[model samples]
Target: MRSAALSCPFALTRLFSLLAHDQQLRAYMPAQVLLNESVERVGELDVPLCGQLPNDWSTWGFVVNGIVTTIFVCLGIVGNLYHVRTLGKHSNSRLTRYLRVLCIWDVTLLTCTFGFYGFVVISTGYKPWYGDITYLYMVFYPLCQVSWTGSMFVVTAISAERYLAIARPFRKLLSEARSVTKICLLLLVAVMLINLPTFFELTQVSCYDEETNREERMIWLSSLRLNKTYMLIYRIIIYPLTVNFIPFITIVFLTIKTISVRRSAISRSQNTQSLSPSLPAKQDSGTTAVLTALIVKFLLCYSMPTILYVFEYSENEELNSRLIDISNFLIVFHSATNWLIFWRWNVNKSSRSLTQSFIFTKEEAARLTYLWANTRPTEVGRDLLYTLIRANRSLALIFANNPPNQTAVKQPRDNATTNGHLCDCRLSESSRSPACEHNIQLLAKVDSHGVIVGIFCDRIIQRLSSKLEQQAIIDEIRALGRIHYSNRVPMRNTDWMLAKQYLIAKLVKDECDIDAEDIRIVNKFASFLIHEVKCGRTCAIAAEASVAYGFYPSSAYTHA
Candidate 1:
């Protein structure tokens, strides 16, 4: 029994050694023989995988991927074209300029890379011949990488720009339209130069199966044999780190930073309002929201694929193929979604009501005037003005009645006092009339530059009438004043003085029925008052200058 047990152990050891020897023999066999054998073992080992492909692609699989990719390509092309045109119309803004470049990148990527791949798979069933053409592989392949990497770089740049705009708005950086365009062009050139190695590293090789008497083409990278280190660096380090990982991290970091900064700014603005009422609050733009949404969507769509790529390993070919298809679809989906986001953003911006504008109220108008003093009137300003006039019919009427350089005139009471009180109209040479006395109650409030800022009837009318009548008169006068103020044109001091005189003459004639000679007299008096005001201001300035120079006005006059 002991001798039989020893023999069994020896037999088991011999069997194991034979199995090891067979494995070694198989490993050293010629590649062609191995290929023939692999074809027979295809069912057991799973289908053959293309370079960097997760699964063995079949005709039907290619067809499906092609169909999905073609859909995205068509949509992407159409949407990006529209985006380019629409953004081009408003290319004055730095953000729009960046977006235009992004759209261009998307179009190029779809046409050169994704679209090309889809065409080849749909037409040729993923055959190696698709890439076997010398120029196609040498030039177009490298260009494809360039476009892909360029697109990632552009997304990174957009994130950076948005972060800076939100976190450090005062810094100039890429705020200018021309600067953004230049940067985009520079990035394109840099990406193209970076991907030039693709042309040199790639070459076509033939794989023959002697048993089946068939030949297949394959893309072989010479760099893998010529310089293994470069292959490792290019595939593992440069492609993933510089082209994918770095940009991904940067986009995520910047997007988070932007969100935090925006929130902080909003909170600070709210607090500032309580502390300093005069400080203008920072307004939010839809562009930031659109960018944020785009970044988030990009992350959601690409994060899984990127992770799979980084940690890629052998797996079930079918599952991997499906995953790859989904990943490719997500990447293409980005182009489609970007156009939609931009379109929605533009529509929302253009459709904003005048009430939402900063130039609607007097305070807002003043603020806008101060901020945009050096710039031309913007759409916001025009919309705000339109809304104001539309809301107040009286204001519109004033604009309609007062044409540029033309003024209506009315006669003033002959016996009006220098103080110009509305009560003085009762002392006119005409018979005592209550209507004349009531008409004299119109008061005009002028600013330092003699522009009529306000007008109203005297409070004596309120005392003479019931509360309801008083309210009605007050409302009427308020409307009239607002209309008059809205009609006043923006002009220089001299022009404004003349305009004010003419406006006052018109007011007198409209309020009180008077002859043409009386209207002329009132106009002359208004002109005389304007001259007197100008002389008084000039004298006051001269007196102050004399005092500052240590010479009294009387002493200066004596010297003269």
Candidate 2:
């Protein structure tokens, strides 16, 4: 060996360069080319994950899926937990509040079964600790598929509750907590048992390869018939349809019914005059809004994946691949957006206080009200707010619109004062049409000039009085103030208060550019304030000033 080293023609430096350039070829270097042949061959042996853990980019499949599973599980757990805690504190009706607990249970199963088990083996190259016969068969797998199906069943249950509460108003027993709880639990158990086939097919196993350190994929190589059947049921039938389709359709149906019931309820109340503003009205209104927001979001976000899964399972491998990728990505967006939904639409001070007293205060929740109030009318805000308000108003009409017991009517008190009333009369729209009499009528009373100004568009100062017509100007002002304070009045010009001030100043000082468009802006702003503000006196003054001055020419106003 020593003599061969001396006889080598090429220097050690040259050998190193060749080896560096072509490490793979170093092992195969012929005896003729190199004097010494004892160097261990690089290409002769395969490298395992020990070589590099596949680097971050190469194992994107594992890394992405693993990370997604972790994040989704975390968020789902956190959100469901928050709901449970909040419900425990604020829920007066045990039956209605049970849904929160059920939702948490379902999401917990999802995190454990779908999120945890699915990602664990891929991440660690071993069956999850609970994949043994006891956990997998007895607990995890069965619970996962069952809970998943139960989630759909729960949605259907919620729909049924709505249908009963709306379509069959007499069926109060149907919405009772005991009945709902028994039904939910029984249905959940049935769903789980039905899906137990999933557990029967899964098996814990170990394998060896050159790349022993690399993460393993769930290769469906076993020849067992049950395994294949399980795969079919999971990938094609149950998971796709139950997780995606059933819930989506159920939510859509519930939303429509809920809306329709609301409209009907509101119409029935049109004849009533006194605004007692019952507690049932307020609580129902708030809860209904939250529920609708939650349902709509569930419908919109979850539908795509369900539809995509259906498409993926049906065939078209190329299409399936693309759809799967898109579906996976969308799931992340779906999970993350829940945090936003809770923060934005579900922030009532009463609810917050209830949550604080009953459930431990959550930092995320504490900041939620502030975050929501301070949020500008940007993406998702306006749409969410409109949907919530509409939903709550409908709920108000449904429960609050119930007819008062005729038997409870007492004789008129001696001191009762009745205003002049008009008899019901029929008016023909045209000579040919059948006429209908109004059930109740109002006598023509002296009209306030202020009411006239608020009612019609005078195009000038008259428009300013419209704010007086709003039912709850004080509440609106407080809400606006809350928003302003929450945001620290980031900019005076941009702030709602400051903006209103500037508009008012331009009208009062006469040191401002006033145009026809300015008058229109003023009119619109006046109209909005009429609905939005709580100040009748302020509205009256503004209206008087505006009617006196009329309006500035449209050309005088310039776009900011």
Candidate 3:
């Protein structure tokens, strides 16, 4: 149950084995001292884990164990608490739920590591008195095992869920809130059962403390430590497998698969875009870089501990002890500061690909552009982009509301899924005029997979004088884009790319000086806005946004 020592349940067995041959704890004691631990010769070594008069928080051991470690634990606790509170337990996003639970478990691990094993016994210069420390440590041992193992499983669950979201998208196993919660809870119970035997690892015995020169109540290694079968199966095999090996393999596998799938999708998207040169071709490299860094960190930090758990140094106990500290420190640092890693990378700078598609795949983004050529009042798909034009209230004024010069041609595509009508949602050269409400146009090809790769949005960047104006326009378009999509299914792909081949022709089209970058920005902003708006927004917010976008003229700029 020595987590700080990479959980060597066999260490106690090793102690007993040495005792049988008349080798004592002090006989083979290393020059180095331990943190929060006590030892004695054959008989005295059976004393409690902690000394009665433990080092004060401000004592000599305080530098490494007192305020600094305490600060780290406190930060970890507060940071995890912040995540839990900020990401509500009932949030819709499955990622949010996973992160929230992860924060909870991380907090537990931090609390236990700091609480029970707070002070370090750096030196053996002083003869410390042994007390009843065995029962308390054992009581919290199960809790540590639960939290430590639980955190790993939750992370694996997250990786699996994300992989499913991209690779399958239709699977609901780890996608739903209730299902995810149940899965997390089930993992907790499994780990608890696995560590259930550790609850009996502590033994109570009356031992004499040389320093105090009196008999003291001590609880150390239990009788079960001598059971060969129990030691081999329970401690050597089950504990390490549950805590490190299994989770490490799972996360690594899922991450590799996810990256492979992502690369395949990107390759397909690039191929699709090659046929249509106008379509925007942008990959979210930022997400890739960030995820790769995180995965590398995980592999490096957990690799040592996983190895040391199954096979400790049989001959060199000192080396084993040193590795234990190193492994435990790595684990502690990784788990506690995860909040910072996630926030620094994910929360602050989100992937621009999200603005293009809900699935955040390039292939999907290419498809979405077709379904959303442009509806009445300038829209992409079913969403209303904005109330761009003002209507006459006094009179029933009617306008042609120009139809985009859409030319649909039947074309056979490379991919079977992308074989359908090729749509061009732009004004013909002859129809180009200044009166058009939207000079901007889009061109796309359609298959059952929505837009696939043919759709190309033509946006104009000339009207906006400053970068702020362009951003405002994009923001406004996103704000007004809050509308329900009919063909959206929770699991299955919708049939709409070819449902209305004529809709592309029916869309409003014009001319613009905008390029591919502008189109990508528009799509990216649209995607970012989709996740933020689940409900309706007030007019005040709308007005504020409009002013920010310079849609409304200031008093000084307004003319009579």
Candidate 4:
């Protein structure tokens, strides 16, 4: 029964061949001899369909694909690893957590698609499972589809999350980490189920060729009626709609909504500021810029691939093949470039003390002022400020207790290391004021707090002294001035001044009992030092004043 079932197709193919040969013979005969023939007989010839290779296998094509895949695999691995590590450290925000998961998905998808395909291309000169019903087709194809679909779904989820964050911050939808995790898990399962048909839609068949007297094996869709219908629906409608059309629509809509919300926020802020002329308008330009860049890159990378996949069943086989290759390349490129995007836009640089100080110099100061003026005080900012103050105070105490020795000091002449003394100030023979001497010891502790303050002050002075423009300094001062006024609870001083006063108080409190007079002295000293620094006094003058009241300055300074 099985043999008969297999032979039926070949028998029909032979009958069709004979009919075609007879029809050709009739074509050479006179038209009058065939005048009595029925119209259907001459209208068309029925042809038997046979399984065949999807394309002519090319060695060059396989080689190029293999090389490209290898490059992508390496880049994807390295980039995703970096992204995971970096983002893991800053996963406090909802967007950051989503991004971390997105990185994971990208790595998985790239490995499943390119890594597996690369191995196949290197081993065989054919693509797309080598047109066989092997493990590649039964397992790998479905796995690749699931990964691809899951990635697209995750991208859409990210865009939606951004929209909610920017557009509807007050809404409680998927705001919790647990909710996000649940949704992601559901999306993964849904995508896997959607792609499950891939495993069964394709199969291997034996084709008997009478002319060649041989049996050829080919990979194709199963001939069962239900399977054929399912394949047609999947190829023509379901896959394209699910993977491309819906995802593209969702992402575009969410991105546009997010932009609109941002613009509205900016406009509202400006309007409010206009009403209160003294208030500064704060625009979240950083967030807007990052989102815009991400949207543009996403469109560029995925649009062509989506279009190609939607029309993949077109009659133009060669055109479709080329498009598939191009789409695959684009997918690889997209996966590989995500790490760059995250690094450029998503990574936080605010945790490093020296770098944060440098970054906050001028424009950041203005931004902070604008933020405070336009928006209500946020606990997050306040907490961060407190954290910094605590860290600095701890550092100051550590150095005061464990001062570096003269022999251990290097670069004593550097503004960060000495108060105009080229030699290690600890080794100075001349008597010095306790204030000046303490400042020198503080400077000697470069590994502790001096480096932080020095780098910040140096960058500030560099930017302020540059010939290009002074607007940056003016903006920073304006922002600092606002901070000084609005911080009613922390004393009416700039954040920097407040930090200095706190440090001075900490140092003085340990030596003597806390008292109003002591507080007054510390405040006075902090004000004088800040004034000197702002007035463009050299590091030496500021250091001298910082330690001047308690002791005497040396008669002569020595160079290290």
Stretches of model 1 off by over 4 angstroms after superposition: 1-60, 126-140, 173-175, 207-217, 224-226, 271-285, 347-560
Is candidate 1 or 4 superior in TM-score?
Answer: 1
| TM-scores of all predicted structures | 0.52, 0.44, 0.57, 0.50
Candidate 1 lDDT, 1-560, residue by residue in tens = 00100111000111112224545323322222222244323324432222222234465556555777788788988999988887767334666777888888888767764433566666655533312432344445555566677778888888998888777653432133567878988898878777767657555554443334445444443534235456456655676677667888999999999999988877754522321221112124455667888889878876865665455323443555455556556777786568888887773343332112211233432432333333222322232233332232222223333443343212223434312222232122353344434333232211111122211112312232244453343334334333333444332343434444433343343444545544443343333223333333433444555567665464211111
Per-candidate RMSD, Å: 20.3, 22.2, 13.9, 21.0
Summarize candidate 4's per-residue lDDT along 341-451 as a digit string, tens digits. 767764554222111122323443443233223322232233323334333333233334434343332333444443333222222235333434535555355323334
- Candidate 2 runs further than 4 Å off: 1-64, 94-96, 113-143, 173-175, 204-208, 212-247, 273-283, 312-322, 325-560
lDDT of each: 0.49, 0.39, 0.47, 0.49
TM-score of 4: 0.50
Considering every candidate listed, which one attains the maximal TM-score?
3
- Encode model 2's per-residue lDDT on 1-560: one tens digit a residue: 11111111101112222223334223322222221222222345422211112222224334444555566666766776776666545433433444564556546554644433345535563222221222333345445445546655665666666556656643332233445567867876767665655555434333212334332222111233124454455545655455556667767877888878877886775443112332334545665676677666656655655553333133343333334444444544444344455455554343431112212123322332222233222322222222222222221121122332321212223322111011111111232112111212111111122133223222222222344423233344334434433433222211323334333333433424444433433333432443232222223333334446663212111100
404-451 in candidate 3: lDDT tens per residue? 232221123432211111112122334323322232221211111122
**Which of candidates 3 and 4 reaches a greater lDDT?**
4
Worst 10-residue lDDT window, candidate 2: 1-10
lDDT of 1: 0.49
The TM-score-based order of candidates, best leading, equals: 3, 1, 4, 2
Residue 488 C-alpha lDDT in model 3: 18
Q: Higher TM-score: candidate 1 or 3?
A: 3
Return whichever of 2 and 3 wins on lDDT. Answer: 3
